[model samples]
Target chain A: MVSRGRPRDMQVDERVLRIAAALMLERGYAGLSIDEVAEQAGAAKTTLYRRWPTKDHLAVAVVARLQADDEIADTGDIRADLVNYLEKIAAGLNRMRAAGHRQGPSAGTVGELVAAAARHEDIGRLTREQYAERNALALALIERARVRGELRADLDAEALFDQMAGALYYRVMITGAPVDRAYAERLVSSALEGNLTCH
Target chain B: MVSRGRPRDMQVDERVLRIAAALMLERGYAGLSIDEVAEQAGAAKTTLYRRWPTKDHLAVAVVARLQADDEIADTGDIRADLVNYLEKIAAGLNRMRAAGHRQGPSAGTVGELVAAAARHEDIGRLTREQYAERNALALALIERARVRGELRADLDAEALFDQMAGALYYRVMITGAPVDRAYAERLVSSALEGNLTCH
Candidate 1:
């Protein structure tokens, strides 16, 4: 039956993604080659192409797998939850920053992925959709906190989340700064505590 | 004398950048060619290469020029000043979003430039320095506000600034959300007013 290959297909997909991620992390974006991946994976070139279509699609899949490992926890303490979530994000970003044998804070493969998305309309749409799905979980977390009176009823959840996530990205992509658990704590503190002098 | 050619050289740089920017914005990053820019600007290829060295160098120069046009104003009121500066940044991002005949929320040339910076170490260093210099002005504004008691003494100025600027960038590069004057206002309000419920 056609459905008989389902389990084998998923195994192959996992193996292929693992190999591709290893190559991308070691060699960077330009260094990645579809033919080389096919050779290394001992898979048919047609099979690889049929599954991924292009190197961009393969790399994106690799990173998407990395992101899926980061699971959010709602521990009821909004500050702790936010800090934990941001730390997960920072960890992912730090891994990307170190990818491709990057020596400094040059954004590494992450910047290339951003450009890849722009170069391909479908990749752009696909990535945006993935981000939207991921963001909704965090947004829902914030919404829960607000509904429980842990946060201000009128607080801007989207802005709050953006500020925290954006700071991690800005540091990695723009300022070449480090994003870590310490920085995540600082961001959460700043976001939770208003900057203005208390009346 | 070398001094005699200085003014003429400046003129040539301006013309070349203007033409190159037009090409990049109209036809996207791939559409831009150093030879085409040289031809359109009526400058010798050698002169262009001597100054820019590569297409990445020229494109970075073009963006640097655009960023230079956005000057930070210290209007005593940090809220108003921050909002105004962020509005300028949002405007620049919106322009980049619309560049190269992009049809939707794709990052367009901005993502390419980010990749360009990552690909070239020299460009990465140069752009980071430029961003640092620009960020210093904003930091100073936040510091002034802190010193004057407009902000909390223990406030995280760097985090605050990163959050605001990072939100704009995150929206452009990741979320495909619109960043405009209205969104800038919302970002500022969120960063300034903490999200925690009042005791």
Candidate 2:
């Protein structure tokens, strides 16, 4: 019986995360509750706790699901590859922006998540680890491109990555600007091609 | 007597802001209060209220003063100018980072100020305007360099500015990384020369 019920756990997780994500989007971070999610998902409170441990953890899981683990590509053309990678990041930011908080020029859910990470040590560690892993992948992509002479040999790879990616986050959080494909293209172009005057 | 007291009012404004900034940096944003600052500075609550209108407004003023109205220098060398601008930004971030959130890797007052901006429309507008003004100056500096053939003619000025400045903000707000003089140099290098390999 236990063997037969193994897949159902996965099903429950899927349902809970789906319902939780929806609740968060509809009402912002303040509206999402584990009890509500459990009731809505038709799962017991124990089942939810066994997986997420805390609401922050559940929020992390929801975001993790939204994050792209498959977007880092090795298309050989570093410019195109960087643009493609940034487009995925921009799409994710746009989705977060769309999730409610529709009234003001605020990055609602994303702001709350940052606050949440600050509040809990474990949650902060886990979320930071996730970003680190993603950055590692991006860095590896850059490294490969460099090896093939597609990028500058002495390039400060970390700073390069930070500028391209940071611009997207800055627009989303600080300026309340929309991070679209066009914006992504502009960012990649500005970053890949130097802004200095040629000799 | 009141006509003679105009300069005294300026002194009170300076005192109140100084004490408020200290309190905010020492106790974080939640611990900062108009009443406490007024009392500490031996001023009346009515006086503070007449000046700032709200705590958020006062906080905005404190930050405005701390921000470098003196950082936008045009030395004709775009690379060096940008680096100097970014270094000033980093120094401010480092100060905020040191404002006693040593317990955790959180952006402490900076994050709270951002949330406060979101919570109040007036604060958000005022803060955004301050940034806009600073950005205009920086953009002008970049434009001058471009016109004088110190920078690329076809460059995306806004994107270039965003990439350089946004990286500093991104590190402070999201990545919990230290933005320093060295980091500023790296950012300028990456943005100016770009990451693309020479053809």
Candidate 3:
């Protein structure tokens, strides 16, 4: 497939990604078809194929767009930064629940896509890269905090990221809970307060 | 349905649970059929259905049994207890990965069952109850630690539980990580140390 040549504006790429994200969220990974994406984006199939060799490529692009849209806070304090991070998590869960309940094509799609990626090597690799990117951001925030003496110097940043994000995602996907702001605050605070050690 | 006489010992029930768990891990939730379960266990369909009305019921039973078998160490130190808890998590994940790779008759069945449960009230309720039971165990562990002065007295037990369990589940279910003992220890230690406001 030959490229129809790059679009005049970056907005075209952004629009395509937005459309892909919405479709994935609604129909799930297995349900998403290239024809659907092309029609939804009002782009040629050849154009999409030129940009993304496979569905995994398309998914990676969409997830990258979503991450780009997510604002990473840097308030100089680890606790405050974490609070902001958790709030974003709570909001994301709420969005997911709302979407799922609306009975649209998008309900259960993200989880389905993630699940599909779990079994497919190429898709799994792309998905892990997305996770690592998000994780790296969290690590950066934590490292900055540690340097500022706001967090324990010896703390494992990757583990902290895993626990906080892991907890939020598990509740949303497995336990099927709201994962509200209050819950996020509690997670951040409890992590800070030392659940395993006496303060 | 007519009442069949009960078995002499509860060993039969234990055997059923073990078989179901193995089937679930190997087949996925969707792959589990009443016929297959009976075939695998050499038990009558009538007996299996009499105990579990649906696959969801069977699954909940299996998970419940696993939960029962999981022993959380109460060694009087939260860190040691957490290490023990994480070790169990790692072992569980290792087992799951091994079973998931086998391409059994029920592959991708668990995800389907879980997805279906999202739409059905009774199944969802049962699944939630199972989740709550597990969550309660984690909460009890944290509460006991707090009472013993091992954890911060002011920490929110529920949130901490979510963070710890949620992170591990996310890694296992979504991110496809090992979630080994070292990972667990780091999580527990970071949350405990990072969350505290040091005296």
Pick the DockQ winner.
1
What is the DockQ for all candidates, taken in turn?
A: 0.86, 0.59, 0.41
Relative to the true structure, candidate 3 has a C-alpha RMSD (angstroms) of: 5.0
lDDT of 3 by residue, B38-58 (tens): 877778888888878877678
lDDT of 2 by residue, B120-155 (tens): 667766777777788889899999999999889998
- lDDT (tens digit, per residue) of candidate 2 on A10-123: 999988988998887787666789999999999999989989888878987898887845478887888888888889988787666657655555665676676566656677
**Ranking 2 against 3 by lDDT, winner:** 2
- In TM-score terms, which candidate is top? 1
- Order the numbered candidates by DockQ, best leading: 1, 2, 3
Which rank order by TM-score, best down to worst?
1, 2, 3
Candidate 2, B-chain TM? 0.91
| TM-scores of the models, in the order given | 0.97, 0.88, 0.78
**Residue B154, model 2: Cα distance from true site in angstroms:** 1.4
Please list the C-alpha lDDT of all candidates, in the order they appear. Answer: 0.90, 0.81, 0.67
